[model samples]
Target chain A: MEVKKSFEEINEKIKNGTAVVVTAEEIIDIVKEKGLDEATSHVDVVTTATFSPMCSSGAFLNFGHADPPIRMTKVLLNNVPAHAGLAAVDAYIGATETSFDRDIEYGGAHVICDLIAGKKIHLQATSPGTDCYPRKKIDTYITKDSINEAYLFNPRNCYQNYDAAINTSGRTLYTYMGVLQPNMANINYSTSGELSPLLNDPYLRTIGMGTKIFLAGAPGYVAWQGTQFITEVERGNNGVPTTSAATLAVIGDLKQMSCDYIQPAVFEKYGTSMFVGIGIPIPVLDKDMLMNLAVENKDIYTNIVDYSVGRRSKPSLGKVNYAQLRSGMVTLEGKQIPTTPLSSLSKARAIAQELKRWILTDKFTLQEPFKHFNKVSKLNTLEEVGKGEIDNE
Target chain B: MSKKAYKQRIYIEAEKCVECGACTAVCGAKALRLDKTTWKLIYNVQKCQGCMLCVSACPSRAIKSDIEDLPSAVAAAL
Candidate 1:
């Protein structure tokens, strides 16, 4: 019997600047164990965003951290199952376990397109009424004649048309939005308009899942306005230091977009099939919105929290806050890679039978006779040459 | 036959309880417990619902709630 958070209701919602949401089963158990397909595959990318039958048999994927980034990564890879390799998983679940009822407004992109098109579709967006608006033509196009005219002019099409498309897209429609500080230090942002290189470019390079992703119950807010184009690179400095001009345009754009991690040839080109992990879903921060953003922007810095997870980003081993988040199983380690395991229920039937045998294996050919793990072989190429089949080979 | 009488008040605070288990991993009213031998933070106060998130995560502020201590703990639950 315990519960609290009252310093005058956390200083009147951070002195009325408002913006804190997170719920939907705390963003589907932190994207079923922190997202980006659990950081480049190993199953458990599952998401319905919130309550459903979801406890495995997963494949929901909805996410809309305030849409319009190539239509939110093409409606999260066109509602799953493209090329069927799997790993759609991103239906908006970055932070929540408390602090909701932000006046119960709704329609985070039509409740993520009616929870990935299970219904409704009155889709409308023409926006251009000034300040940073770029959703020109979508006056009604989630096809099939707008979901049969949005279920024949509303046969109780609930979630209230995502609150009428967030009141005609004035845009503060967030339901479980993420990253409360994610600027793993490579900041640079000077441009003015037309944004969305994945949400107003802070030097985009955010590939997803399984590298620890969880942030429960509000509190995560790290949008540090591109940490004022970072400069501080003095610890180790293996390279990239031609006497600052923003570290020579951030080390000539991280040596033409290489963003670290290629050593041992990317673990000898996927030996052990390249597995990385990160699972963070620790949000319980409306301590009066971090004490009114640390008393009005603690000298206005804003790197928007990236608190490093693994594989040497300034070589970390801290910052996994919310009083050290917990609640049944979560592991991640590096170098010799021992810790792994992030999704549970006893490692989900041996990681879904090793991702269904690494999707019907092809084990880089050794020219015949190698079919081990329970049979699979039918390789042919003779061109019907009756007589000496392999003689002309 | 229903009357408006459902007061609130359910709290805990065994010295800023650090037996982490995140308020019993989000207790929808499993009625909080983390006493694996004197970790000290058990409860059954009629399966509480004043949900203050263990008093906004008591890093040692300890928990609190007292809506007149819920009609004498619901009159010792009937």
Candidate 2:
């Protein structure tokens, strides 16, 4: 039989304040020094993390019914439009939704951050009145405390891997990846390198649907596999994908979240977004998991893609590992270009440490996913149908 | 609020700043970026129009806004 540990066993140690927990970064040195066998046997949990701009993040809010309730047909939070297609007073504010009256500077991320900071938010809604619920329109203010429920329910986040970006065009390209300098003058990338949760468990062995995680400084749960949860992507020698891979949909209480972990960001001419800090503690279920946790920055690789093409299928420029990306420069076509890792590494390190402390102090417990994610293979595409004939010219 | 009416002043605490380029991404005035020589976050007070976007974009919370008392070097740059 193989050496293994159970969630019950880890929780028992956590309760007694005896579980040996380390971050994915710390596990590298521990394995390097003590050897994989000794390190795997000693470590009970390893936390992985990332604090990066997650564009597919949002919050669902349900304000309790008013005196004579109105079914909200349109909703706006602090001038930012929210999806009001849900129930009477419930709405989903996506992070990327820009303010109706302002530029990209103010948006759903600002509204979400204001709510998290306990600042008041301007709320406005319009509805076509009905007999039972006969209110026409509403204009009011709401804070996180004032709302009945405010939860961060992101559809896609924690991207397993993202290919670095470079521009081969004549002009600077303002993209979600960052400002790509013209003529391949700069290479832009975003990841916490080895500390990323999905990279640590590419196969989704220990991470599952019910897995408890630190989401935006709050204890949250993995809702499901995210929007583009592809598994059949190309991989490097280290078992990590070199392209965009698995993502996670996470849910947490917005009231319990802090502004520090959910900071807002604005990409010039692109849109508004937020830095979603997510940390997952991978319980050392077996030596295989521990070995996975011990993976380092050098082994993880990503490809540099040309963003100048402006298409779904951009051409791959070159294959580069995280080590080369982090070194601040990469050689593409016999020329060196400066690089920028757009994600906040300091915040990622802090989130990992915070998650480690949560487990060591017994505040968090490991959960084997209630159900393993559906092994989705092929992804479908939206077909464009023209009434007459498809024009290719 | 007139842009010229208010005298805006700001400073980024050097030791606490992480030079993550988050500020550079949001800065509309082109006042913030990591110095190519030292790779340290540099704020060109001369060029800063003081929209204060960097204050929120900074992950370390090192950027300060609306300071009445200004250092001589910062004032000179301004």
Candidate 3:
């Protein structure tokens, strides 16, 4: 199919409220009925979304300066420990970090959620007296309003594809994948089926550095390639990985975020995490991009792995498509195994629909990626360094 | 049926509470409050009316209740 509009022209159409925007959920049915050419010509943007519990997420907050401006060496937010190793007033609170009071019910993710919910959190910090900054201790209550800057600068957020976890052993397993029933009785998957952001842009064509995205509830950008991005994974005919592959590091202003999009989640056994709602708008640059966006649940595949193993490389039972997974049942060894998703499909749809409304109303505009992601980056496995071996590569 | 026909009470597990204040928001009886210092949910059984609204509103399944069977002597005495 010959392309008629450039990215700039599409932006012009978006500004004028003339661009045809549909969500990834809507485009599947559109493509099925109208074919790729007709769908590509009709749709100017495809909004993709996913609401999942991302454990490797955190927020960096600059609480401004205290009265005496203490160089905070140790920090705690609502009993949850935050990394105060940065500047005097800045700290980073990871999602999975538990409180110093050893409360499993609350964690860093809960603190971030409480702040977003417009609730005040107790902020306590300690520092030795310094020459320039003489304050030694600070104990106060802080809300989102009290902090000068509170932004989520997650090192990793969206995964291209992930594995469905099941336990084969006689005992149950408490993992980041959620609680898995023993003897492969139940499986837990964590993707939003077809509406996932990375799955929509399998090859990372429109999603890259400086790409504007709906993060949590605020407008954010792709900061960089996500940590532990395995780009060398096996791909299907459409260049979409069948297993774990690409990821995106994103950053967004926490002050602009809403509690509706970002929620604190506590797994029954896996502790605390954040259910981050992310939406990315893919500008239909060409027919190939349209086809990628048209990719459905049956086209995307992931492996069901046994999480009972204690090693990094677990045994994979077999491959399963998102369609089968989303059906809430998949056959494993001729037996029907019920499936549960850790991600919320309802929340994902809400985000996609919300983003679609934003684009349709000209409230949110599409952004051209400053640079496309590198395809040749290799993921290295972790290895223990031998003593007295100064290996320099 | 009278109000005393069924024995009811609200069970609040403070250990399971994340202090998100969702239960407090849904509690019409104002039985639940967050301790500002400890950031924990404080439940007053006297103020609770066994509405069970907080039980369903709790995201963490922290709140539960049991309906105790009253003895005939106790019911008659009351």
Candidate 4:
């Protein structure tokens, strides 16, 4: 396919309300009817979206100093613990962080959600009285507006693809994948299939640092390669990984986020996590980029993993396409297992539609990446080295 | 009466439930309640009429009808 318009030309069309924009769902059918050449010629942008429970998510808040300005070393928000390792007024509250009072239900995710929901949260802190900052004890009520700076700087948010979990043990297992029934009675899979962020960017060609994104109702950017990024994972012909591959570290202003997009979730046995609604618009730069956006449920696949094993590399029962997984049943070892998704597809589609509306109405604009991510960056695994082994290396 | 004469009731899987209170809102018999102290959903088996409303209402698929000697497929999985 020949490239007709440059990125600048597309941006000009976008600004002038002349560019044709379609969602990932819409483009699939468009590409099917009209070949890649025609699709790329007509469509200038594709909006991809996903709403998943990302555990490695948190918010950095700079709660403005109190009357006496205490150097807070320990902080609690609505009885949920917040990491006070930052400066005196700044604290980072992790999504999976649990409270000492109610460990399972109420957590840092809940606190963040409550703040987004416009609820007042109790803030408590304790610190040793120092010379510069004397006040040690602090007790106050704070809301999202009251905080000076509240932004979500998640180390990892969107995963390329993930594993479907099943329990092989005789007893039921409570895990982050939800309740995995014993003997593989039920399987829990979490992914928006074609709408997943990294899946749309497959080879990481367009999505990189400084890429504009719809982050929980507000605009955000791709900060860096997310933690535990395994870019060398095996891929299919479509360049989409069949297993867990790349991830995106995202940063957004939490104050601009709404309660609808950024929700706090509590997994039964897995503790607390947050459901982040993210939408990324991919510019149809070339035929390759267009083809990556054309990936469908049939083309994407993931492993049905046996979560009974306690290691990171759990044994895979077999690989199943998202088409089979979305059908609500997949045969594993000749046994039909019922599948459930922790992520909501309806919400994902809504986010995509919302982003599409934003782009069309000139409320949001696409951005060219300042620098692309390193595709050859290797993810290292932890290993126990022998005494003096580090010196030898 | 024989010991087997008692009818089977609804079972709430505590581990599977996220305590969203969806089941409690849909229960016509008032058989389910969320415990405030522990934040766990409590199932009153006696009040449960085996309506199975809570089973269908549960978002996480945590509630199930516990019928003994039933068909394996129905009893085994949701």
Candidate 5:
């Protein structure tokens, strides 16, 4: 691989307002029309994005010490429980934490989004008072302006690839993938295909730790590799993973976020989750990078797993590419199944365009990763000692 | 059915609908369907039986009946 244009050169072009930025979807047409040589020389960066429900998302908030500061042992914001083991007035609210008062409709994700929308939230905490800070209980209302620090620290988001789900059983299945009709009447798949971040940078060449990204409406950074991240997966011919692959642990300032990008949602029989907007700019440092960005939905494939199975490794019916999945229908076992996307492509495209604007306006700049992620990780299954035989040898 | 006669219609808020097809899946009637070409939700009010399954099945709460909304008030006024 040859470096056609360096990051410094791209940054200089961006600063001079001369950089030619295109989205991952837009780059395909450019490459197809002008060839790789022309596309490589003309484009500076390709923006990729995804807006979907990410379950492993939450924020670590530090509420400024109150008068007669009490160490918060149990923290509840808007009746949703938050992890308070960190420190006094500091807690972590997970997105999927359901509200104790409002049942499954409202959750920690709602609380976070409401706070972003400048809504007042009831804050209550109980503690064992100490001599230094002697306050047992307190009740008060707080807004985003009153908080000291609110930063989203998501553990697993921007999944490199994912599987479409269908129900093979006789009963309807309500899952994180959304509701699936029994006997494979409907298919629910996620991930903004062709426009997803990791899919655009399959080899992790440009994206890594410390890379700046569009987190909801605010700028964020990739903190580390996310949970259940497995790099070694069966990939397609285009070097993109065919099944679930890499993930990202991203962090950003929640104060600068907006409700338009970060939304709260509830799955019907399941639980609460969050819909977050994420965008990443992949620098076209070389022709290979341009070629990767040139990859289209037809080139990316994912397995359709049976959600009716209540197990980690569900049975995969068959492989279907995104082009077919996006077509709203796919045939399996000689039956036509109506398919719908869980991730919003229109919103994803908007985020990509917004990130592109930020770069063009000099409001944001791309950063080279300080370190790349390891490509050898396996998701091991936890087995009960008595229920299943242990396989850790 | 006369033109002036009030008929119930299902309305889906575009902003709230993610088009996950859950409503179509739960709809026992053939009223709610996803366009095979565009993957968009298409609701047929005539085929609906006032079951309100989609309205309840919608996780985003984006669906509603026109007869139960402002349309009902208009019908009463007329």
Candidate 6:
């Protein structure tokens, strides 16, 4: 018998979910080798990321009531599901929230999602400040000596200084609020020390209504465009240009989240009344491998499969465009590691099952199990977000 | 009881705006959008209930209102 797993088997695994973490660079490697489909044959991939200068773990640990982390993960995972055939995955947090607390540090990656989702209503200190309360001297950077001497010099005054610094940091400070492809591309270039398709072809306008972009981390640019068209830079899927199997894994994780959380709320908020923009990063797909897999699994519909493309990856066209093309958690392995690795497929299914249980559990007490919501006027026509229609015209 | 006067006025600075559309996104009165002729953001001030959501959501902080100018304008119009 062949050792390969079937779609149904893999689908079952995704229904139950967990943190299927990988890096974006790794997916590129997988595409170059396996062609994309074979590599992603099994997995539910999405981007769940945290920013640097901060550890994602510490942010989760400090989640005021521990609900922010759960709410954040739940929101990302709700975008992807196997049955609907939409690709979606949880982008992992790259760093902790503390790293973003520095003065002058406008904000970090995770904070961006919160900003878009309306979770984090206020912007905090990105850097620290100094003051001249007693002597009226200028206060600037935070130093090791200052850290050690804070208490010794004046404990109460130290609190005063820190509070003043924290408050002042938000004043007149500017940052990119949402996911901007160009900005994302720039950040990726600086971090990975590599050039990306998004930066080189900065003018490509790729977007589609079927895709809903998730910010794995905080505000990098202005704000979530909340509309489909981005002009100053490329549209969605602007940065990534590697055909890889790992992209499938990333899509799988993201799809699960799409179905579970984002679909309902985004549909409600952006629905029929107003236009909304989604900033998606593009991923490579091996057309041949994808065709073969579907052919091999003759029972699956091409339409469903095509729709599923929106899960972890984006189809290089449409108004819900791709931008700031940057990499996710997957590292640049020669044969890119599957974003939603076949091995980790079961983990995703488990998570999905747990989420279903939680949604039902909370429904009774909260009346609405979903957390991230916008109370827009009652003109909601979209039955679901990132699904509705593409209007291919 | 203390006597009080109610008024409303809206102002926008074009330079700072990025046109994120958050105002139109949440406007209960359907009074905001990018003006087609100039692409400058505009609003139907009359339809606005003064909820100030647009005022709050302006990412660029370019929107302002004149409480004093509104009542007189409304009274004069009436």
Best model number under lDDT: 5
State residue A367's C-alpha deviation in candidate 5, in Å: 0.8
Tens-place lDDT per residue, model 6, A304-338, is 01111224332321111011111111222122211
Tens-place lDDT per residue, model 3, A1-393, is 486567788888888889898899899999999888888888899999988878889999998887778999999999999999999999999988998675656898889988887899999999997988899999999999988989998888888989999899999676777666678877778887688998988888888899989999999999998988877788888778988888889999998898788877666556777778899999998899998998888988899999999997999999999889766579999989877666667677888998888888845887777888777556767788887765667
Select the stronger candidate by DockQ from 1 and 3. Answer: 3
| Model 5, position A316: C-alpha lDDT score | 97
lDDT of each: 0.22, 0.83, 0.80, 0.80, 0.86, 0.24
Better of 1 and 3 by lDDT: 3
lDDT of 5 by residue, A199-223 (tens): 9989899989999999999999999
Tell me how large the interface RMSD of candidate 5 is: 2.9
Off by over 4 Å in 1: A1-110, A113-115, A127-393, B1-46, B49-78
lDDT of 2 by residue, A316-350 (tens): 98889888887767889999877777777777888
Which tens-of-lDDT digit does each residue in B7-52 have in candidate 1?
3555453322323322443344657654432323466667877776
Which parts of model 6 have CA positions greater than 4 angstroms off? A1-393, B1-7, B36-38, B66-78
Query: In order, what are the TM-scores of chain A for the candidates?
Result: 0.19, 0.97, 0.97, 0.97, 0.97, 0.23
TM-score of each: 0.22, 0.87, 0.84, 0.84, 0.92, 0.22
Docking quality level of the chain pair in candidate 1: incorrect
Listed in order, the DockQ scores are 0.02, 0.19, 0.05, 0.05, 0.33, 0.01
Fnat of each prediction?
Answer: 0.00, 0.16, 0.02, 0.00, 0.33, 0.00
Q: Is candidate 3 or candidate 5 better by TM-score?
A: 5
Score candidate 6 by lDDT.
Answer: 0.24
Which numbered prediction scores highest in TM-score against the true structure?
5
Question: What TM-score does structure 1 among the candidates reach?
Answer: 0.22
Clashing pairs in 2: none
Q: What is the lDDT for A96 in model 6?
A: 18
Evaluate residue B4 in candidate 1 and report its C-alpha lDDT on the 0 to 100 scale.
19
